[model samples]
Target: MTTNHLELSGRILRSRRFDSPAGIHHTVLQLEHKSLKTEANMQRQVYCVIQVILSGERFERLTDKLKAGVDIQVSGFIALQQSRNGQSRLVLHAENVELKN
Candidate 1:
């Protein structure tokens, strides 16, 4: 058995909209995450920018509310971002989201 779950809290750097072939609404966002973590007995500051996608009703509800620089907590699964160029990328498919100050 395998598991593919992710939980992240970060600032939304940007957002855009696209439609599926079946006319379903989809929202894609760029999130920036930063934190201090202890690894190998040392503390380090880690930072990363990730892509996140939202679909269905959640997409509609969050489309306008999620502005750039908004801090939010997201829980979801990780999926590959398919590209025609054969490049493999990781994307977070958000299942739940919450706004935070």
Candidate 2:
């Protein structure tokens, strides 16, 4: 089986909560990441913003903790989400989220 997992640390740029028709609670977060890495024996600076989805009742308790400007770490798998306009974007489905000091 192939593996698809990713872990990223970043600051929350935005956060919103909503409930599905099925009554499941969901929270979406916009995360911004900046880092430096060595590539081909050279240092490179990287920056990106990604959306993160946290679903289920367990995550509702964390809603208050997820806010803009807060630093956090999230780990999960990435998936393609299609919008009603037929546009597709990559989103991270967070299985775990932790606040950074």
Candidate 3:
């Protein structure tokens, strides 16, 4: 069988469109932060992935820069996301979206 293929599945929590040195595009996300409120938690935070939709004008450059979220599957391999103190965390990068409850 072939190897070296990476396929990840996750839930989308946030999405937004932003401008960066790379460009602007739809960015998606999945968060896995632990619930500190629970002290007797047996399981670590799971994985999630959000969807993003950048403005039509700047979709290409923001593809990779979009930084979509990975599922619990890709957490170890992918760096745990972090934001500078006081800085807001970027969950996703999309201009338009519809979330389901």
Candidate 4:
């Protein structure tokens, strides 16, 4: 068996809500993260921007709070999504979201 899980904390750079043709609600967030980490036994600064997607009615309650500039932590799985142009990118599908003080 294999497992795929990830947890990340970052500031929301952008947020948007949309409905699919089947009426499924989806919330997309662009998150920016900056932190210091130990790599190769040395301290290094890490910075990244990633896309997070929250889907279904279960995440409705948290949608309103997923606004730009809000600091939040999200726990979920990562998947590759292909766009219309056939380019694939990594996206985090959030299962849990929390506000960070």
Per-residue accuracy of model 4 over 20-75 as CA lDDT, tens digit each: 99999999999999999999999999999999999999999889988998999999
Candidate 4 or 1, higher TM-score: 4
Query: What pairs collide in candidate 4?
Result: none
* Model 4 CA deviation exceeding 4 Å by range: none
Give candidate 2 misplaced runs (Cα > 4 Å). none
For 1-101, candidate 3 gives per-residue lDDT tens digits of 74332334344344454566666343444433333233476545544333223344644553443343422222112223355675443333333333212
Q: Who is ahead in lDDT, 1 or 4? A: 4
- Per-residue lDDT over 50-70 for candidate 1, one digit per residue giving the tens place of the 0 to 100 score: 999999875587679888989
Find the candidate with the highest TM-score and give its number.
Answer: 2
How many backbone clashes does every candidate have? 0, 0, 14, 0
Q: Global lDDT of each model?
A: 0.90, 0.96, 0.38, 0.96
Candidate 4 scores a C-alpha RMSD against the true structure in Å of 0.7
- Which pairs clash in model 1? none
The per-residue C-alpha lDDT of model 3 at residue 53 equals: 31
Ranking by TM-score: 2, 4, 1, 3
